[model samples]
Each structure stands twice: as structure tokens, then as C-alpha cells.
Target: MGPSSQSATVTASLDQLETVAAQLFPAWLPGAEGIATTAGGGLAAVRSLAIAHAAGTAQYSPFLVDLAVGALAGAGPNTRRHPPEMRAAGLARVIAAALGRPGCALLLRPPDDLDENEALALVRAAQWLVDHGRLAVWISSGSPAPGDLLPEAGIARPAGTTAAGRPGPKVHSTVRGTVRCGRTTDDHYPGERQPGKSRRAGRHGKPHPASRTETLLEAALATRPWAVGRAWNHTLSPGPLVNPVRVDLLWKRERCVVELDGDDHRSAGKYADDRQRDVLLQLDGYAVLRFTNAQVHDDIENVLALLQQFLATRRRTRKGH
Candidate 1:
């Protein structure tokens, strides 16, 4: 075959592979009897049976071998192979889709002839998919070990039941909880009034405790700027009737607050709310500093410098006053 013809053949095979994966993913690996038991015995059932038949006929299934080779091929004059980074990204998106819907499945076969870096990238992507749970991965030829890929991720092909011995639920449940820090109950902030011990006893009591992000900011301050335990809770003026807003990280002495903006803050409504909060803080004679997770993770030094600079200015202003 000419180079053009070979490339077209490879691309066509990949299209077939994608179609097969889409068809078989929803049914999972229920055997022949299970397929019949399912409503309609559907397209997925037929595809699954076809794949099984193809696999048993040959040691290396020609049906999927071409697709796997094409997936691992490097960029060439007439090749449709995706770059390593792009391949990993595409796989991640597929895995996410599979996870979002129950009974969705995918099979990735990496060619054994891949270079070290290519193999490593594929392995990492596979590892990530398996780590997220529910998604079962099978590495037929180029696997590091027989079952090592599945063991660490607690994933097994043709999974009869979930790790907990129950049928896999469609949606994964997430539990959110608060992390309490500091010493024993006696170790309270200087101004923070304990529930019953404080002289200023009232129905409302002190504002909500500092969040985990605030706790980290406090620790970071202790290392730099030397502002340890300086954060104080300052409730929004005219006070909220319900679930009153409170600054995340505050330095009462300097009248500076640091707000850790998370992913939710990027939403239009939340972004507007954030701007309002900043305006309120500014109007209340306080400097509000905002930092996103990316800034903290990617540019820690700069974030710390900005915070330090804000604190210094606030402190100097307080001293001048």
C-alpha cells in the first residue's frame, strides 16, 4: 500500500475503534446470558459479543491491534497519531465521560513498541483513570505487569461487583466536612470568646471560625511578614440577617483581609458577589487581597510578596494614623 493509502487505512481503523468503544461502554462486560437478560439485548450486547468472539479467535486480536498501533504511532508525514500530551488529555476527557455515566466503559491498548517517554505518558494517563474509581482499565500487551495496573487502582476488568460488593451506583456521593485545627479547647484566640467562658455572652456569639485556607495563610504569614495570629473576624456592617458574611483571612491590627477565591468564584453570580465583598471591605476601612488556587500553587512567592506588601502598607498607614 502507498503511504497515503496506509494513513487512510489507519485513520479508518481508529474511527472503527472509537465507534466500538462508544457502543460497548454502556453495557459493560455482562456475559452472554446477562446480555439476553438486559432490555432489548441491544446494540451494546451485540458489539460486546463480537469483541469477545474476536478476542478468542486469535492470541492478539487483529480487530483492535491496528487501532492500538495507530494510537501509539508518532507524528509522521502522513500519520494521524495524536501527540503524547494531546493523547493523554483526550483520554482524560473520555475517562471523565465514562465516570459521569454509569455502565460506560473503555478499553485502551498501548502498543509494545512505544518509546520510553510515550509509554510512560500512556501509563500515567491509565493510572489516573483507574485512580478515580469505577472505571476499569485493561492493558493487554504493553502493561508493566500482569495485574499491577488494576491492583493499585483497585480496578479489575469484567467487574462482577464494586469494591463494596454492590452494583456500581450511577452517581458518586461526595461528603464535605470541616477541619478543626489548633490545640485543645482551652487554646482559643486572644479576642475570640469561648462559648460559655467569655464575659461578653450573647445569642449570636463569635463569627464562624477561620477556614482551612485561612489557617494555611496564617501559617504562611508566620514564616514571612512575621504576622502570627493577627487574623480577626470582622462581620459585615449592618450585619446579615442570616448566614452573615465573614472575611476569610484578616489582620485586625493592619485592617487587611485576604480572600482565597476558589473555582466557584469564577461564576458570574459569584464573581459579582466577590466584587461586592471587596467594595464592602474597602469601604469599611480594610484592604482586601484576593488569591486564586492557581496563584497559590503556581506562584507562591509572588502571592506571599503581594500579601506582605499589603500588610506593610496597612501597618504603615495604621502607624501614621
Candidate 2:
């Protein structure tokens, strides 16, 4: 048996935390590949686990801290396969936990009555969590949230921190080197072009404009300045389709198009739709290219290079046009 000393205080630093997770993660995550980013994980991960717990998931294994932060940060990895609602719910729970609140069921399904400050506090907290992703905590995978995982007794915010008068029942998220919520500040968050949401799936928080296309475009942006998507335009002679016909990727002036050929694109139903769309757009003189998902993933760099060549050719063509 290990030393059984009731008096021994065991403190966990970020280093200690990473060590524990490194040993535990591999066993828990079977067939885990590549380098583990756990050493860099921090508060965002911690906030997420609390969220997973509150979401009534007894098994936190399914919802790691990194996954939660990814969802919050709009950075998806393999975790995207999970339902978006799960991510949303996890984010919600994390915010509630940050405020020293338990039983987040109440926040989502609040009691019949809640005061003005209580309601405002809730909104401010969610905004804070979403905007300022726990950048200080480096681990890109999973880490613990700051403060008590479960707040003990009466809630607390930093002393003399409240700007809008006396503190309410809500616990504020105190980010190091970041402006605290439920207070006044001139601080603007990172991401000059970050999207904001009014509400999430059955959860009270701001969601972003992140969709499947946004994610794909974001991934593409890392390498290439151009990405193709099914976009709509009303400037055509026939005034475009009834809705946006999937154009894959369209380089306007240079006139290029790219397609993501998933199984859906091969199936008769989807293929027919795609062919009709492609035919119409092609008739409009758009230079089209196609690639499979495997091709994109297997060699993104090569694919991006091809696109750069296309863009260059198109630039010349546009000059002629």
C-alpha cells in the first residue's frame, strides 16, 4: 500500500497533471496515434470535463478536455464525429462550472424564477469562455479548468472585482491576463473576424457561424488561400438556381471550380444533382477540378500546390478576359 498520510498535501502542477495524463491517456485511448499534445493542455480541458460530468455522462472518457476546447474554439479533430449538440452542451456545462455552479440542469432548464443579475451573469460568463480560449494553458489536447471543479458552498469571485455593484449568486471566470467577466473592460478578444451566436442547441450561449463548409475552408486556409464551396449568386442571366447550387470551389475572375467527391457525389441521386449543377456552371465557362476525400487528406500539400497552379493560370486568363 502507498503511504497513507492524511496530513500529506498533494499539489498538482501543470507538469504533474501532464505526467498523470500521459500515463493514463494511452491506456484509456486505444490505438491513439501520433504525438500527444497533453503536455500543453490546460484550463480549457478542465472546464470541458466539468461540462461532460454535468451533461449526465458518467464516463468522462468519451469527452476529453481537449475535445471540449476544440468545440469551443471551433477547432475540430477526430472529435468532430460526435454530435454538435454534445459539444454545445459540454461548453454550456463548462461555463456553469466556471461560475461555481453545480447541477447545470438548472441553467439549461432554469427554475421558474431568476433575477436580472443572475440572468446577465450567465450570458457574460458564456461569452467570456467562448471568446478567450484558455490560451495560457498550453496543452492542445485536454487539461483541467481553473478554480474548483465543483465549487464549494457559497460562490466566490475575486474580492473587489465586481464593477456593476455587489456580487450576485454567479461565479465569474477569472482568466489570467484576460479581462474578467461580469465586470467592465475595454478588452476585445482575439480573432478579429470571429463569428458570434445568439443561442446554441437547447443551451444558452453564443454559437459561431461554423458549419461543415466553414471547417473545411478553415482547414484549407492553413495551406491555400482558396477553397471551393457550393455558393449562390444572383448576378447570372438566369439569376442563378432557385438556391445555391453546389459549386464546390469557384475562383471567380480566373474561373475555377473544385469538387469534393465523397460517396454522395458518386451515388445516382447526388450525382444527378451534382452533374446538373456542374453542367450549368461549366456552360458559364468555369474551369472545374475534382478530388476525392482520400486524395485531399493523403496529400493536402500536393493538392494545395495544384490549386496554386490553377489560381496562377486563372490570374493570367483573367488578365486576358
Candidate 3:
């Protein structure tokens, strides 16, 4: 395929993947109101064992518990000594962390050699996660039948893409750094303009205007001598299977991230997503600094001073280590 065709294909596949994800997870829906509760007193969740080729390739089932525990407690011994409930809770927490919300759908791919008893165990485990952890568990296609143990959910795998290989929307690199899917180059730091290159256009071919608050902060940072080596709208991937997040500003050498929050961030969903992003970034050893739009607009000088302090602190800490 030609470059444009390949890009278009990838974009379409990503859209399809998102559609599947949204169908499975209510929280992923646009304007979703937190985690929904069912009339029967259960958390609104997807409990079916989804049978699909993508699930088999993803292989998140076997190490689900381990990944969860490791994420929470750091690298350590096996969690075999932990109770089943504890393990389930840990798994749920990690999955929630990865997806940025509790009760988000989880796709599990059972091992190829899974027996009927093992399949039953998997179903029971998924049930525990749904009941106690409030997670939507989708067991991927192709496991041995567990005898009516789980409600069936169908997921049509996208052609030529495995679950693991599914692409997200393209993130384009700027003169200074890469911009993730949701942001545009007009959001780039004010002072980092590339020589002879026009301002990068947004998806609609017009520049996405930066918020006044962002522009004010960017302008101030541009004049500050200490604000060197910062990249705006940079992407950071926390770990495997997790979507990359774009920070408003990043100083990679100092492992510092700054987020400029607008009114949209006050929503319950965005608040939860921000918290999750912060947790993941912290786990990856980056210090996250969050500033609201009002803060930057009203107290530009103080914001700059505080940011300088934090950046300096991070640099010192890194040097000390």
C-alpha cells in the first residue's frame, strides 16, 4: 500500500478498535457519567468471555494478577501468598489504573492449554473482578468452554491487526518533540519554533488556537532563561498496553511534567483520568505539576516562579541520585 493508504488504513483500524472498546466499557463512552450501576445492585459491567483472534494475541490473562501486584507494590516476589480476593482486587486496581477508570472493560486471553476446570477458574476469577472489583472482564476468544460459566460476548477482530498490534491515532513529531493524538502543534511551546518551517496545522488544516491561558504561560516561559530544554505537548508512554498521554510541558532530563488544565478538566471523568495519568507518571519516576487555567491567567508570575522552583528541585534530585 502507498504511504497515504497505509496511514488511512491504520487510522480506520484505530477507529474500529475504539468502537469495540467503547461498546465494552461504558466509561469510554462520550460524556459517560462515572461508573454506572445496574438495577440488580451490581456494578454496570461487561462480564462476558469475548471470543476473538485479537484476544488470543493480547495474552493479558495469565499475568494479569502479577502485573497488577507489581504495579501497586513494585517489583517483588510472586503474589501466591495473597488471598484470592486480594489478588482480584489488585488486578482490578491495575486494570483501572491502566484504563484511567474503575469498571472499565478488561480483555483477558486464556492460555491455549486451558482445560475445562481452568476455564471455569478463569470465569470465576472474572466474576470476582466484576462483582467485587467492578471491572468489565472480556475473556478473549478460543478458550476451552467452561460450560455456561460466562455470558458470551462477540468481538470481531479487525483484519490484519492483532489486539497487541492495533494502532492508535498517529502522533506527529514537532521541531522540539512529538505531539500526541489529541493535541496540535499550535499548542507547542511558544519559543521553540523551527527555522523556515511554517506553524504546523491542525487536523482540519487550520491551526488549532492555543487557549489564552496556555499562550500566556508559554510566552512567559519563553522569556525565562531557566525554561530551557522543555518540550511542549510531548508524549509519554507509562507501560505496555497503556495508551500514551500528552503532557502540556515536559523536561525529560529532569523527569518533570507539567499539565495545564482548563475548565474541561473539572468534569468527573476528566478528573479521574487526570488522577490516573498522574499515578502512572509518578510510577514512572516523573514529577507531575498541575496548574489550572485560572492559576496561569491570574497569577502568571507566581506560576512561573513555582514552576521554576519545581524544575530546579527535580534537577537537584536527579543530580543527587
Candidate 4:
């Protein structure tokens, strides 16, 4: 009932945790990439948060456990109730399962009925994992009171917005485990088979440099100050609707996606898949634009012009909304 001694300890809401999670992955965090919280249960929330954090990549597998449930059920016979120490140990085992894999982070949600002592036990378990340095832990709670062991983290804010206009409370300090965004390069693309300067197989088998088309398109995209991210072979969604297909280019801030069609795209299956992806992206509220590799090389000026107009319109639309 008294004021908690741990009140000054920082706590991150689900929103803050989501921002931190998004930055950890190599995908764009803006636009539809934001995590959506479910209305159902904490398990749903944790899973959704993990998906959003992974940014449509197969990089993360979120493991969820309710400590309170495990404590009540008891891990061993002859005991129906687990003490805080036992509960913490149970949580540790669960956390260990998520470790040893690259790019994997754990999202742990405490049981709803946890008391102060139990919550602290859970916090200690999470802290121990964080200190180990292999796995990252995100604690999700529907309503976290002060003194909960949620350490403060800096949430990425929308650019140029003042504090008063910003939604939710503001934390000026930088987040503890924030990952900064970098320019997307060819090496970062997942599953890119060719490495630096390897020649094999056929006339086209050499690890060639950037094509003229790719160069022109990247140059044009670079001129646009409004586009926060311009990534090739950018994976859109690793979820059920669209997975395994990578976008030719992505503009995160404007939510505009562009795909450069090559000879392969004209085939029956590829064309159909392209159309399906466009439709799915449109339904997800992104503006989809398609251009040919020829268009990129031959008529790049016009292509840039078109993208400029689209980016402007999208920005205005976002501001209006």
C-alpha cells in the first residue's frame, strides 16, 4: 500500500517497447510496419509485438510465458504453489530456450494476477537475462504501475513534431538498446546469393557491379529528401499475407513501394505474383508503383518526376489526416 521504493525506476509502455523492437530489425519501422496491439489477451499482444519488431523477417521467434500461471501450477510434484525463487527459475528456463539464435529476442508477459513480490521476481529474471548479453527481453503489461522493473527506453518519435503535438508522454533520454537506421545496401539483403566479386557458372554468372538501371534508380531516389528509407529487395511482410517476396525499393516515411520489373517479371507466374503483391500492399494502405528496368535506365527523369509527385501527395495526405 505504501509508495514503492522502486518508483523512480523507468517503465516502458507497450508503445515504447514496440519502437525499440522495430529498430532492432533491419526493416523500416515507419508506415504499416508499426505494431498493432490486440484487444484480446497479453499473449496476443506479445506475439503481435514480436511480429512488428521482427519487421517481416524470419529473424525473431518470440517465446511467451506467464510466470504466475507456472507458479500456481507448480513445476514439480508435492507442491501446488511455487515460491518467487522457483518462479524465477522457471522463467529463466523459458528465456534460455530463445537464446543462442542470432537476431532472436524474447517477449515475456507477467501473469495478470501477480502481486508485488511476484512482479519483482519476474523483473529480476528479466534483468538476469539482459545482463547475460545474448538475448533481449521485452516485458509487456496492460497497465504497468510505477515501481515495476520496466527500465526506461527512448521511443522513436515522428520527425519534426513538437512534444505537445506528440501522442503519449515524452521521454527525452535515449533508449538503452536502440538500434539506429542505416542506408540499405546490397549486402544487407537477405538470401542474396552472390558475394563480393565471384565469377562462376555462365556469362551472366559473374558477381557484377550495380547495373545501370539500379544505379539510375538509386541516384534518383537519393535526391528525394523526403524518403527516409530507400532499400532494394526489401522484405515487405514475413507474415501470412505476403512473405518470401521482396520489394524492389521501399520508401518508409511516405509508405510508397516501387518494384522494378525485369524480364523475369513478365512470366505468367511472376506477373501474377507481382499483381497479387501489389493488391495486398494496396490493401495494407501503401501506395504501390511499378516500373520496368528499361524505364529506370531510359526514362529515369520521368520516373523521378512521377516519384516526386507521389511522395509530395503522400506527405500532404499524411499531414491532412
Best by lDDT: 3
Candidate 1 lDDT over 136-182, as tens digits, reads 33333421221221122222333222235542211111110000012
All candidates in order of TM-score, best leading? 3, 4, 1, 2
For residues 1-321, write the lDDT of model 2, one tens digit per residue: 011121110111111222222333323222233224434444444454435553564324455555434433434342445444343344333443434444221101122243444333333333222223221111100111112221321323322211355321222333211111110111112221112311122111111133233234436645554543223211222123234444334455555555544433444454344434433343344544555544455555655666665566555545665
**Predicted candidate 4: what Cα RMSD to the true structure?**
19.2
Candidate models: Cα lDDT each:
0.39, 0.34, 0.43, 0.39
Q: Estimate each model's TM-score.
A: 0.32, 0.29, 0.38, 0.35
lDDT tens string, model 3, 107-211? 444344654444445445444444443343334333111111111111122122333674322211111110011222333434422333333322221112444
- Which 10-residue window in model 1 sums to the lowest lDDT? 172-181
Model 1, residue 295: distance off in Å is: 1.3
Off by over 4 Å in 4: 1-209, 238-244
TM-score of 3: 0.38
Worst 10 residues of 3 by lDDT: 171-180
For model 2, what is the C-alpha lDDT against the true structure? Answer: 0.34
The residue-by-residue lDDT of candidate 4 on 90-176, one tens digit each, is: 233332222221222334434445555555554544454333322334443432211122122222322221225533322121232
Badly placed stretches (over 4 Å) of model 2 are: 1-217, 222-244
Report the C-alpha displacement of residue 50, candidate 2, in angstroms. Answer: 72
The lDDT, on a scale of 0 to 1, for candidate 1 is 0.39
